[model samples]
Target chain A: MNGLKVIETQDLTKVYGEEVAVDRLNININEGEVFGFLGPNGAGKTTTLLMLLGLSEPTSGKARVCGFDPTREPLQVKRLVGYLPENVGFYDDMNAVQNLLYISRLNGIPDDLAGIKIKELLKVVDLEVDPRKKVGEYSRGMRQRLGIAEVLIKDPQVVFLDEPTLGLDPDGSLQMLDLIRSLSQDKKITVFFSSHLLDQVQKISHRVGIMIKGQMVAVGRIEDLAKEKFGVGQEKYTLEEVYMKYFKEGLL
Target chain B: MKGITTICRKELADHFSSTRFILLFYLILMVSLVTAFIVGSGLRDELKDVAKPTFVFLMLFTSPGKLFSLIQFIAIFGPLLGIVLGFDAVNRERSARTLSKLVSQPIYRDSVINGKFLAGLITISIMLVSIVLIISGLGLLLIGVVPGPEEISRLFIYLVISIFYIAFWLGISILFSVGFRSVATSALAAIACWIFFSFFVAMGASVMADAISPVDQARASLNPELLIKHEQTRKIISLVSPMTLYSEATTIILDPLRKTTQSILLMGPMERLSISRFQSPLPLSESVYIVFPHLISLMAITLVCFATSYTVFMRQEVRST
Candidate 1:
């Protein structure tokens, strides 16, 4: 409650026929904070991100981003929120600048403004050196960096990263973490990302939410979560240990 | 709505720059120009003996030798161009993992499909218009005959009809792209549909027409009553294939000799009037009215296919995988 709520969900649910992909998830993320969403594979992490972005509709319940209901005012929510999907893709035929320009246009940025913003973003993500290179020739790490630039193209208030560092070298991962950190501290933008990389999440995230089997089991600061799960005087376990404990408990 | 234009602009750039589009564009342009050249050469010889107003205009599209006319080539290959542009329109984005990124933008879900569909149609229009201009230019150079006002009006109608025809195929291709997950699967489905409508439907309709009303061998010629029944069956069956509607409309527009509402007249019980009896060419307005139903049917089929794609796309869920 210290900061204004940028993202809120109440009993948000998504079911696919007999399978419940996301079930009655309730969570709130404050503004200008790096919120790490941690879960194992098929834990409904991506599903939740999609629902919040208004890319996929929830079966029932309500969710809001930037004070707009995602289902009712999806376009409004999407305008203020940027989402970088896992395994980000670009039109291979287009150069780096062209790809970013294309995205900027989709977000309703004019040509002159888009050009200036794209150059700035490319510089921000360190892709300005070879802005004219076709994306087909880009490496995994370069593409991930470009993906970050794409999310920032519209100057969104809130950004979602679904496993942004899923496939990258150690160097690439570190660079990505630096970029995410700068997004919160320098740009004052809300960052919500899901990842299985506990070490990376622990380093950058101020607060983390752990989900398992379509439900949020834990949400708080790492220190507070550790104190609550293990006794206050007990050994200080890392996010990896804390995440595994909730995931295993959810199995039962 | 601005999202539609943005997506369309991007899609157009992609289509215009891609090697696949370039190859198809050149192939279509080269083949069409070559066809026009051959027709122009033949018309040069015919124009010397007799001067026919309609013949001069029609000769550009009509065949000179045994080769198929320019219109026939378009009627056959237009769907291929449409399928090429649209088969991977949506699925490629999905497979490339760009669909989620594009949809996650501030645009409505319908915009993506609309933009892609609109882009394909625009590309089709560009191709068709260029070919027309090139042929007309070549005709003026080779045969020294400029189309009259009537010819220009007819040609414009023909162009509009061609757009609708290709748009119908584009719709079908996009529909497959929206329905299927894999790019290859959607492409295969679109090609299968093209073949079914292009060739198989005609053959099937013929068989069904023959079965529906059998022709007696006792008479050398088809009687008025039996011809009417067969024609009715054929019309009803051909309505299922968009190609039929397109070809029918184009023939009426281009030839001006054929009419849509043709009925057999039997002066006596044993004697039936021939098609030559009604061989007088109608004016442009009358021809349009005659082929009005075919035009409407073509538009209806295209709209239905587009509506299906729009619905499926809006309902489709985006997965990060």
Candidate 2:
């Protein structure tokens, strides 16, 4: 429960009145691994991410992020875990540096250190082009990149990106994918991302978990899941085919 | 604690930088300066009738004219400043989608509310202090009056009371911000409450007093008991309004000749110490005790509003935004 795994959940569940948002979720994400949490809309992907970040409490059971219970030691968990919500927002009047400085302060990073870290992360995310410009003036792609820099402000051990490539063009998504890839490869940070795009998940995630109807239906390396259940020749099939095979009947 | 400081600093920056806040502050300042000018010229005529120089300083604040005095203006308009600043404090963050990001940080959940409320209180403090300084400086420049130590202390207390009144409005406005999802609705709610307390409460108190205690005008001269009952009933009914408490406290502090009681037979210890009405201002500590309940009630209402907002903000779902 502590070593190797950066995130571990035991029967973590979230219920909103009559609707079960997350149903007895048990997930383990190891350190330094890129994990893809795949689901259709309303499939509880955001709900699970919220619980993991300690922003929302699960109806039952618990989750630990970076060896700290999110419900009990939420501050400690938050210290080591970063989250970029779907459609991340920034203060419209503030420039990129101000927004990131605010985040670094909230994380208790010293001002001088925050300045250096923010400059570095801004360059890493390629948002250093016009750091003085207001966020309201930024394009959709630029905002997402700034969101990446924001998540990396604390140099957290784990990062959660809820549809980071959402609303992006093909070129922008490709850049986002590269930035996400470098997060795990170069920084050795655990990246847990949620997306509905099959090809995007297949390109970056080391392992993928597919959730449907508030339940995780499939999890593991793509090759293993396809070879074992989808048939002999399906191992060579694209992730889109594998996704179609598993979700075709359930989707309709 | 550090999180609270960070949030507070950011909130203060936002308030000070906003055009709305700057414009409203200037409006308040302009009106206060005008009132100071009018009171200064008027006090020049009154100084001939009264030899007490201390009375001149107090007149700068309490003089009545076609326009309301500085204190009355604040009593009416100060709440708007607080409401405008705080009406969207929480809801704006939610609408802008920054609240979820703020909550997901390492800070404690209650820190958001605490920081916001603290920042608002500080802003109110700064605004009130500046208004006091401007009016007093204007009085010095125009009327050539050097306030005595007692008068300065009284003005300081009055300034504190004004701040408490505005902060009460700030608390309720923030409460709406925390409770409502829409910023417009929250602002509307705060203004509605302000109208109710500022205008309707006084009318309601008078109507309730007349209903509960019908005056016997036939025996008017011999019925001190009836008059006291009517006054007490109106006061009890209007206790819900912070303005009533503030006005009551200011009268005792600014006008030494004005006694809290209508009858001389029920004179308190402080009133007993003075042989004449206009001889001198009451001692600062003694006058504070005279209006102690009024001050406490204003503070208590502000605290209750703040506490309610704090609770609401803490229990709210971050994901609901």
Candidate 3:
């Protein structure tokens, strides 16, 4: 309630037949805040992102993204939110510029504006390859950089990156983390990035939300979460320890 | 609608540049032109004055160019054009992890499938039209005869029908792409369908007809009525395949002299008794009217395919995995 609530889910739930992928989850993400969503595999991180982006419908409850209900006004919501999926893909035969151009057209950006924007965005992502080189020729790191550029094409207010650093090397991961940090710092874009890499998430996020078994087990700044767990006397607990703490409890 | 056009343009560009499309296109063009050349030479050498054929121009398509007629070649190979274009249309995006990024854009979900189908139909039109035009030009050069307005219109109709026939296959491949997640699985399923329609339908139809209306060879010349029933049953069952429908429809469309698809067993006793049953080609209108039912069936199946894919794609969850 202290800041403008850009994303709010009220008892949001998603079910696949008998399986509950996300169970009555409720969380609020504020404007201009880098919120790291932490979870292991099959912890409903992607299912939650899909619902927020209107790519998948929720089984029950309501969720609003940028104050727009994703189910009812998906186009409006989509226009304002960018998403970079895990191991993002591009048309292998087309060059980065061409692929971005296609996405630009899909977003209804005019040719004149899109041309200038693409050049600038490519530079911003530091992808200095040949414009004619097909994406198939790109290295994995370059493709991931292009994914970031692809996300920024529409100048979205918020970006949801689902494990953007999954397959990158140490150097690539550092570069990716920098680009993600810059997105929130310079562009004032609210970034909700999900990752199991506890160290990486700890470096950039102002606040973190931990989910276990389709439920939000903890949500707060690192200090507050540490204090609540170890009871007031501890200075802090590493994100690894905190994740382990809840993970063990959830298993039991 | 803009989303549909944007996606369509991208898909068309991709298809035109793809190696598979280029190879299939060249194969079709070379085979078709060679067939026209052979047929044209045969027509030119024949005595024009002796047994003059009405539409010598139309013979470029229906004549025994080499092993089979041009229409027959298309009947066998044209579906490959559509299948190759569409078999991986949706599944490729899924496997590559692009479906999530694509549907996340501001466009409606149906735009992806609609645009792909439209792009496929356009590509089919372009390929078929070019082939038809090149053959017509070759016919003019090889056989010194100009196609009349009616002949031109008949060629035009044949081109339209050919586009729709191949489009039916495109729809099928796309339907498989939407239904199956694996590109190889969808492609295999599509090729299997093509094989069944191209070869097995005829074999199945023959077997079914034999069971429906048996022919009694023991009766000798006493009754041709039983033979007629058997032939009619075979034709009806063959109609199940789009390949059969396309071939039969184009047969009458290109050759008006072809009076009936049924066997001579169905000839009425009164007509058979006549000494002279003079042969004359029907008008173009009559030919189209005769094949109107076939065209309807071809179009209906194509729509069914595209509609099924469209619904499935829209309903599918745009997941990352």
Tell me, by lDDT, which candidate is best: 3
Q: For residues B65-184, write the lDDT of model 3, one tens digit per residue.
A: 558889999999999999999999999999988988999999999989989999999999999999999999999998878999999999999998999999999999999999998999
Most TM-score-accurate candidate:
3
Off by over 4 Å in 3: B46-52, B268-277
lDDT of 2 by residue, A48-135 (tens): 9888888888899888888888888899989988999999889999999999999999999999999899888888988755756899
Give one digit per residue, the lDDT tens place, for model 3 in A1-252: 249999999999999989999999999999889999997789999999999999899999999999999999999999999999988999998889999998999999999999999999999999996967999999989999999999999999999998989889999999989988888888889999999899999999999999988988999998788888878967368888988998898878
| CA deviation > 4 Å runs, candidate 2 | A1-3, A248-252, B219-224, B261-280
Separate clash counts for every candidate = 0, 0, 0
Candidate 1, A139-210: lDDT as tens digits: 999999999999999999999998999889999899899999999998889999999899999999999999
State the TM-score, rounded to 2 decimals, of chain A in model 1: 0.97
The best candidate in terms of DockQ: 3
Any residue pairs clashing in model 2, and if so which? none
**For model 1 chain B, the run of ten residues with the poorest summed lDDT:** B269-278
Candidate 1 stretches greater than 4 Å from native: B44-55, B219-224, B260-280
Better of 2 and 3 by TM-score: 3
DockQ result, candidate 2:
0.85
